[model samples]
Target: MATMPRLLFLVPVLVGLAAPPALAQSEPFRVVNRTTAPALALHAVRSGRGDWGGNLLNRGPLAPGAFFALRPSEGAGCSFDLRLVLQDGQEIVRRNTDICTDRTVVMTLSGAARPVVPAPDGKPTPLPAPAAATARPGVAPGARPNPQARASTGTGFVVGPDQVLTNHHVVEGCSRIFVRAADGRTLPVPQAPASDARRDLALVRAPGNPGPALAFRANPVRRGESVVTYGFPLAGLLSSGPTLTTGEVSALSGLADNQTQFQISAPVQQGNSGGPLLDRQGNVVGVIVSKLNAARIAQRTGDIPQNVNFAVKGTEALDFLRRNGVQPVLRESPGEERSAAEVGEQVHPSTVFIRCER
Candidate 1:
């Protein structure tokens, strides 16, 4: 490597869970995949309001040229922001389009790379995420947040009944921690959370059922294997509901060849830290941790990097949970891969958007 990319910084980010099974993955409009690449996920949130309702194509990915017909919901409004994540981790968004007036939305890949298949490769109901959160200098590993008046938001997944997992930065310096499930419920964190800032992880205990806990993957992630990220990224700007992105394990080490962390190409923005990184089988492989500081790197190198994010390894998260005396669900990779939408449905009830108020 000619020059080392310096920073692997952590920040707050999040996503909402999906409606329970009372509702299915069907939405109110038709989405046609007119691209050569398979679509890993599709989401439609009511244009300017509402979290991402659910993965519209939860049953499976939309094969190239396949069209999914959504019968209009009785009360879901007409306008929506339709986002599609392709297998190569490219997102094509059709924003604020009326599903009622334009009943069919056709999508085509926007000339992003369609690579050869590499071997690997939300929700709870939600409360409206804070209209905004205050940002500050990030906390260093094992360092507590300085007492302040700003709140940070991050994503967390259920590791067990009533146990939500997230990054310590999301909880540092907060007067209180609140978790929003997919079902429009706001859960209060009753006790002080168990945290390991060294690993950048925290476990918050909230009351009520958290649906099925996500299973951690039994094997190590392979370089170039496809992975999916589910979190609430840019909720203040994008939909607060679960946002999904797909990409491959770019490398097996982090900045400075950190073994406890891994490099991924999945796009993660502020408010996404602490979310789960899943394999094609919906097994939790890592925790969405941080991304390179692009502007700083750009100034140093005269070029900017894109989608260079990192995650804490699943084994590290598992160790943290066990140290906290929480038993987590674990699973081996199944023979088949699931569409990102399917993973969202299976784990939606288990994922929560975390908001920490200082």
Candidate 2:
């Protein structure tokens, strides 16, 4: 049987796009889905890469009438090849497109002419743009007020006697934020957090001390290395204390080969963000960031990828803290291996429950 063509390359695409009438000003750049069918998969790679990185659409397919921004790391290279898979299982390939220079890259199923808008001045807006219809990287379009005062929770860990580290998105628009220690005492986050939204990191101080801060590993993490994570997942719905889960380092890079993050096999959940990913010796290696949206991935691939989760590398977190004038307590991993229980007990005090109320 003849093999089906999975990809269809559109070569020599004329480089011009006209701003559509429905385009919002705050969404400075976007991938307008002008096609009638859903855009099933999206992939991008540097100009010369042999293969594309992880599918950028893992969050969910870009359905008809929707669009996505091309978010790259700060100062990353501009030239990239974009691959868009359509519902009919046909792929659209655009070669060496300069996302760094364009305001928006639109996807279409129809061959009808699209008005080429003038290129916006300067570099392209970053990908995976915030769900909010805004121009900022991580800021969502608008805050939906929780009038009923609903409670949402996530995880964090201590970096110093007073400073706790967590994901900025976890506490983005909170009217009040608090940290709960293992002892069940709730401490207030006295002031606003110092955050790096692009990196999704936040540094906030607790009134009193939580406990001995967890230490960062001095060396880089390797693939297949055993690791562990602790967090208060599904808080108020699960046990009151922190939960520990263990796995091995599946990959050195994260989704789309992001070097600043790790692809871990360790299981994580909504409440696991900002929790620590530790080595066998109880040294911090990374911070649990997110897990693949398995349901969505399965919808596209027809098979679920097992145990694919991600974490921010410790190096990135360390740099963020230092830039903010907070030096983390760094330590080297001991040669000795500790049991999961022992490591859990040693790090438990540093793990904290982060609560946000609007």
Candidate 3:
């Protein structure tokens, strides 16, 4: 039987006007295809605010290293969101750039080449270079030391321009916390006054100057609903940033005690502590704290217990930040955000597989 090839999606945001004057010249952009299989077909859709318009389809297959040119439709002051859907129903959605005047934008589509593996002969083999490694700073020849190589894995996100939200256990006794952004920028977490220890949360100022603006969600989530979790699991084995995992709400209330925390069915591993749990719409729902271990409970109670996990509620985190005058931009979902497959190909480097050093 022939195995089906995986479909890839690329959501490229093109900003500019759709008028004749704007279409006269085009700006250049790049689209990288990060999949093992060749793209059988490519399609693009234009949308704005809440309206989705017509779609442009590419009939031919976009082989590895192929690039496509996107042209704007004729219209003045019309803003659009570009969505790319692959043959297998995967999508990449991005907000279109605003049109200042009539101008054209050019974009290039780059494909991910398949990796080369050697046969079982115990011989060294070569592999294709990965799509650019998320932007990393250059190290001098024979540099004395690299802090990140010896950093600890912890769950954290920007709460302010340079501030981060995480658990005290994550950075507990470490002399310093090494923070990395989704874009592959390395940063340092400066010591900040710890919050109420009962909550197990703390604030740390992210180094490297200013980073992405902090965002928080105010909507409440219910049980059995879909949710996504992000964090760095098995540190050192993986790079640091937002790692995405999907699961459903197992329980809304707490299992241990009211002071414990809410529980989610999401499967989180070691090094994932203190990561954010987001809703299907990409809103923060809670912060992953720990997984419910039946074995541990069984050992304590002399009986096997059910497995469960705990998370710090988003509402609680929001309240703490607000009362402390953190003032994060709290916003409700615009409607239904794009699905995982529709969002765009996620770069795995954005996620770091974490492992402890014994």
Each prediction's total of clashing residue pairs, residues at least 3 apart in sequence or on different chains, is 21, 13, 24
**Model 3: lowest-lDDT 10 consecutive positions:** 13-22
Q: Look at candidate 3 and tell me the lDDT of residue 326.
A: 80
Off by over 4 Å in 1: 1-150
lDDT of model 1 at position 153: 70
Model 2: how large is the Cα RMSD against the reference? 13.9
Off by over 4 Å in 2: 1-148
What tens-digit string does per-residue lDDT give for candidate 1 at 151-197? 45778899998899998656754556678887867777766677776
Against the correct fold, how does model 2 do in TM-score?
A: 0.61
Estimate the lDDT of model 1. Answer: 0.70
lDDT of 1 at 124: 21
Best model per lDDT: 1
Residue 139 in candidate 1, Cα distance off native in Å = 23
User: What order do you get sorting by TM-score, best first?
Assistant: 2, 1, 3
What's the best-to-worst order under lDDT? 1, 2, 3
The positional error of residue 279 in candidate 1, measured at the CA in angstroms, is 0.2
